[model samples]
Target chain A: MKSREKEISKIEEVLIRFHRRHETFQAPPFWTERLMARVRGEKMRGNGFYRAGAVVWRFASVTCLAAVLLALYASGLNVETPYEIVELMFDDPAGLDLALLFASL
Target chain B: MAHSDKETQDFEIIARIMGGDVNAFELLVERYRPLIFGIVMKHVPYDRVEDVAQESFLEIFRSLGSYAAKSPFSHWLSKITVRCCYDFWRQHRNNPEQVLSSLTEDSQQWVDTMLAGRSRDAFEREASGREAREILNHAMARLSAEDRMVLTLVHLDGRSVREASDLLGWSQISVKVRAHRSRGKLRKVISGLLDGRQESI
Candidate 1:
């Protein structure tokens, strides 16, 4: 068993040496240039996405504000109270008083 | 530059990158190219070193937002580099051609010399040859990617489990378990080769 352990240790030593012998290689002369080009391309693509998102956000904000203003206009903002709003919404355009509409309430 | 100065500069460059100055990134690539290449070469095949190194740098750039300055930038860079190598192996794991190369006769002779009860000096000299490397690679190819990486880091490269865990982003216990298991697997591969040789004789 001892001899077997010794043999295994020797094998492990050789394996360690295999790793230690890793060769030192210089980066290719054009490696940095190529890498930088890829990075630039990635940044450009990211910027494109950011710009698209900004445009969409601006459009959505404007559309939302416009919708809210339209809704307020349609709802008769000139009316001052809940009763006035109800009268404004239900009164006939020909000038019916709408008193019957609220009498049950 | 001093280590602290380099760290400070790395932060400065990262700030510029975040602030929309893409050209500033080239400075970082130039500064760390050697370090990145060295790490990749140790863990990746020679032919794939450039591709893997490129992937690592791209990942570093993409992940810069998450780099919280909690540790030295080189340690973070190392973690990325090692992970990239691990990824390369993982991707290649299914390709039988990458894993199925039989041990050559020359490597078999080298293995024989290792077990021939030779002197330590003789063993060292023999282990430095190309055949020794071939044998090691062949044995490693048979193991899974995780096993191969853990064995390489802990057994062959002489890194502690803590160091391996940090580089691999694995829990310490996970690294320890994989390291022990992979070492046993490696031993089995070599012993199987020896037994086959003995049987033939």
Candidate 2:
């Protein structure tokens, strides 16, 4: 198998080199401009999509966060103030609001 | 400046492009035109090779900012080139004749000159040896895309079996085994063609 592999490689190399040397080279030079144009077009198109995605994600996030904050504001579950909520975990035995939040969701 | 020197200058241009300077991407394109074209020609038809090659370069530019820089630049470029050429093949799957057009005339001329005794005589020292290879390429075209890609990536491109495996995202064992199998298939086809050629002769 090794010898045969080598024989095949030798034959292929000769054929390729022969093909390469005799092949007349021609590729349209203007393709550089064409390609660059396409690149720029795609870049613009991608940026447009990115901007649109950014807007959607931000709106969704802000809306969700705002809904959470607004619900908390509306609930009026004041033991006293916003700082009182932070202390609730450590001190407040009351778990009623937690149950209410889950039930609402 | 010399082409290589100019090409080296492109790294700086690429750095800027990666830094969000879109204009610098053009320099990378101008610098690597022939290299990308050469890679494309290996798989694409002779006519559509240029645009497809250009598409690869654009993909490289658009995505370069996310590149990990762990791999060699050409390997990264070659990955995109392979993918773009595959896309070209997919679009042209219904018609193989439209593969790559930029080099159709030259390629036809190339085939004509090759099949004739004119170019064969140059390798007269090894003319008898050349017949098998021409047959091999013909046989190669008949293989499935998966087979053809594994064969080209390993054999024609001189990539390591491991590297070819990595490029194609197959296990190294699979690459080695598939490469071995494809060679047997190629040899069988070449032998068949040789028998037919000899009978005609």
Candidate 3:
């Protein structure tokens, strides 16, 4: 009798679930059409936007690498310049010249 | 004149949608609207439900191409819908409280009296059922969004704790604990509401 009662309860739950499902309307008619259009548009938007972004990123990376290379070459090539020589003198102000010390010796 | 079979998985429809078949996505929209609407309606005001529901669909569409088919499509779609609903909720300035839904014209009165009366017990239960549901609904509104969602999915929707966890993208342990706690909370709130209702009567 207890087992029978459990079965009855389970059936009641199933009936409740059935009522819930039956009572609600699904999507309205026109929304489905609208959603389809929107989905297509969204897909197009993703492809268009992301592709454009990818191109921009590629350009940016290349530009960044080129700028770094140019900076390195410019600094490396500056060793023989008069301004560089003066800048070196200023850079070593804490150290005295070896030639002046040798002449005194 | 053909409707897509409901039994087919989402990935199948999605593949067609990507290949530029617009109607495939329509099938998807039809299939999931109720599920999406259920989640969104809980978080948003009546004014926002339609638009937010649409936005949730859009979000799903926008990200559909990136869908990896790892989880079932419904689970993935549910996460997007929940996030969209939350965003709508967050955008509201007045500290938002969730409310149990009452019927409007658009609300489906799904319980047909004829069928509902088929079982004498159910018929007797029906009059009191709405009151019970109403109490639970308002009581549910006072809970946190996560708790509200966990409760709805498990109790109202009749999903397994595991399925609810999947729907919410929550871990099994967390889902179980939340479900247990939310029930206790609901029980307490419901009893209070019932007591108050009786006193008022």
Task: Give the candidate number with the greatest DockQ.
Answer: 1
Measured with C-alpha atoms, the lDDT of residue B141 in candidate 2 is: 62
DockQ of 2: 0.21
**Tens-digit lDDT track of model 3 for A25-93:** 345567666766676777777778878999999899888975565445446546577677556557658
Of candidate 1 chain A, the 10-residue stretch with the lowest lDDT total is A95-104
Ranking by DockQ: 1, 2, 3
In each prediction, how many residue pairs overlap at the backbone (N, C-alpha, C within less than 3 A)?
0, 8, 1
DockQ of each: 0.46, 0.21, 0.16
> In model 3, which runs have C-alpha deviations exceeding 4 angstroms?
A1-22, A36-48, A79-105, B1-24, B31-52, B85-120, B123-129, B171-173, B197-201
Clashing residue pairs, candidate 3?
Answer: A23-B110
- Summarize candidate 2's per-residue lDDT along A9-45 as a digit string, tens digits: 5445554453343233366867667777777788788
TM-score of chain A of 2: 0.43
- Recovered fraction of real interface contacts per model: 0.66, 0.23, 0.25
lDDT of 3 by residue, B160-184 (tens): 9888776667898898898888776
Decide which is better by lDDT, 1 or 2.
1
Q: Which residue pairs of candidate 1 clash? A: none
Task: List where candidate 2 sits over 4 angstroms from the true fold.
Answer: A1-25, A58-61, A71-105, B1-12, B18-20, B94-137
i-RMS of candidate 1 = 1.7
Q: Rate the local accuracy (lDDT) of all candidates.
A: 0.82, 0.63, 0.62
